[model samples]
Target: MERIRLTGAQATMLATLYGKAMDARSPNSVLHDTMALEAVRRIDHDFSKVGIKPGDASTVALRSLHFDGWTREFLAAHPEATVLHLGCGLDTRVFRVDPGPGVRWFDVDYPDVIDLRRKVFPEREGDYTLLATPVTPAGWLAQVPADRPVLVVAEGLTMYLREEAGRELFRAIVERFPSGQLVFDGFSKRGIKLQKVNKAVQVAGATLYWGVDGPAELESIHPALRCVSAVSAFDLDGFDRVRLAYRLLAKAARMIPVMRRMAIMYRLEF
Candidate 1:
């Protein structure tokens, strides 16, 4: 089968799907996320089809669930705030969030992803808009309301970006919105090195370029940005319900911080 030509960021969405599917034994958002994973898994790419191993699949599911929990918590508290899902890929967060009457939602991604999203998801009728532009592009921010509080979600995205690009993107977001929150997952140096050796990651063209050793580093990039919560996959309480092997692995990872590294979410105010 001929392989599909997907950018590194685009491929990361596939990884998200694969991960979600692996953890579908529960009644959480993972069940909904599995839809996208199943869609991509059926595609004719060799790496997506055969190269993905059990471990890689587990990682994706865990990360997706973590993001889903964070998003739910954030949206529940700030019903009036606008949501900017950077690198939105094929996620159905709008449906999951089910924004109330006053809430605004925006899904931003590459043209191809946005175009594909249009076909996969329902049209946004009220305060939602789908913007087809790269996350780093200056023009995309113009479409969003500068005065409203915005919540930006960047999942499985920053790792592909060079450190400077990621920093600049964060700075631009904080400067663009007067008061908002930015939730993203970060890769540690050890996690990046692990990806280099992982066959599935190599075949997918995901090369980790940005790894913040600590969440405090984000504060230095922009003073307004506060490190409200720094969570690792191991720290999440949900892991206790997982299978024995997964729970054990999560426990061991916590013992050796570098084993799984950390993924964090931040709140930025200007």
Candidate 2:
């Protein structure tokens, strides 16, 4: 088994990984991600330290499904597009989506995280690549051919970056790709200040720096950028499938505007 020594925000990935695995094991699994289940069995880390509660599994699964749906939507229309999964940390999205042969997929993250990924996940086929880097204004983005329509997905990443850096990262991608979509989930400013609410972030003792209050915050960045969708947690397609406890929590959150803004998923076209 592969042992891990990641800490801080990087260590938080393990919590999310564990949650997805638990979700996949459930009878009414949201993602039905057997890949995540396999990954947990292969890792030798102490998941208890990550502080993933039973209820957290469905939240992780639903978030992944939301992104996966958008990815499938894009690929169904443009089967030959390029996909850049930024801050990819042990996520089996490529395995789950299983894009067509004409597609080019890149799973990118920090060098150490990429190294851990190789240890746990087996080799894959297709025009797939894993680029390991710090993912700032990510110089590695330059390596990806800008010729095709791009689909950029960043999960649980932007909060770790300073607000300016997050915008800059998006700026780089929009400037490089002629036309494409940027899909990601982000916290409201209130959410960033209340990081203790996120079990993984609390357990990892990680600091979160940025908050995306709404789609207009990013759409203002570039002339070509347009907000395609800005969905709150309650608005996700599979809300009814989420466990009862979280469904109740979402109900209560909806009563308050600040709580409602705590979690949001955004998709933009440029």
Candidate 3:
């Protein structure tokens, strides 16, 4: 089995990877990412240390599914568009979305995380590239073709960066692409302040910094950027599939405006 030695926010990817793996193993798998399941088997780490319960598995898978759905929608319209998946970690989205040969897919992350990805995941064929670099203000953006429409997706990545860095990252993507969409999950300020109670944060000893109460906050990053859609976490596709306790939590989250904003998925068009 492959041993994991990642630390900080990078290390949190393992818990999500394992959560998706557990979801794939379940009878009512939300994302059905069998590749995630396989990756977990190849890794030597004891995932139990992360404390990913069945509810967490469902939550992770559901988030992935929502992002997958958005990607599918974009690809169906522009099959040849370039896909920029920032902070990719160990996610198998390239496999999950399975875009056409014309769609160039780039998975960006730190060098060590990319190295771990290469070890656990199989080599993908046709128009797929793994970029080993931090996404923020990096020259790595030069590697992506600027002509085609771009679909930028960042899952479980925001809030890790300071607000300035996060806004700059958003500014960079909107400025780089002529036309396309950016989809990501964001937490509210209260959520970031209350993050110490989060299991994954405890496991990885990670830090949270940026937070936005709404998509309007993201729009200020670039003049061309426009809010397309904003969906709360509990309102995602597989809400019913999650256990009742999680469903109740979602219902409760809905009542509190800040809590509702705490787990929002936003899509913006430029």
Q: What TM-score against the true fold does each predicted structure earn?
A: 0.85, 0.97, 0.97
lDDT of each: 0.70, 0.88, 0.89
Weakest ten-residue segment in model 2 by summed lDDT: 233-242
Question: Which pairs clash in model 3?
Answer: none
Off by over 4 Å in 3: none
Instruction: State model 1's lDDT.
Output: 0.70
- Candidate 3, residue 129: the lDDT equals 93
Q: 1 or 3: which has the higher lDDT?
A: 3
Write candidate 2's Cα lDDT for 1-270 as tens digits.
Answer: 888888888988998899899998899899998888899899898787788866678888999998999999999988889999988999999999999998999999989999999988989988999999878966888889998999999988888998888888888999998899999888988889888777688888788999888888989878889998888876677778777987888888888888888889889999
Of the pair 2 and 3, which is ahead by TM-score? 3
CA RMSD of all predictions: 3.1, 1.1, 1.0
lDDT of 3 by residue, 129-232 (tens): 99999987656787888989999999999979889988888887778888999999988888888988888887898999888888778888889999999999
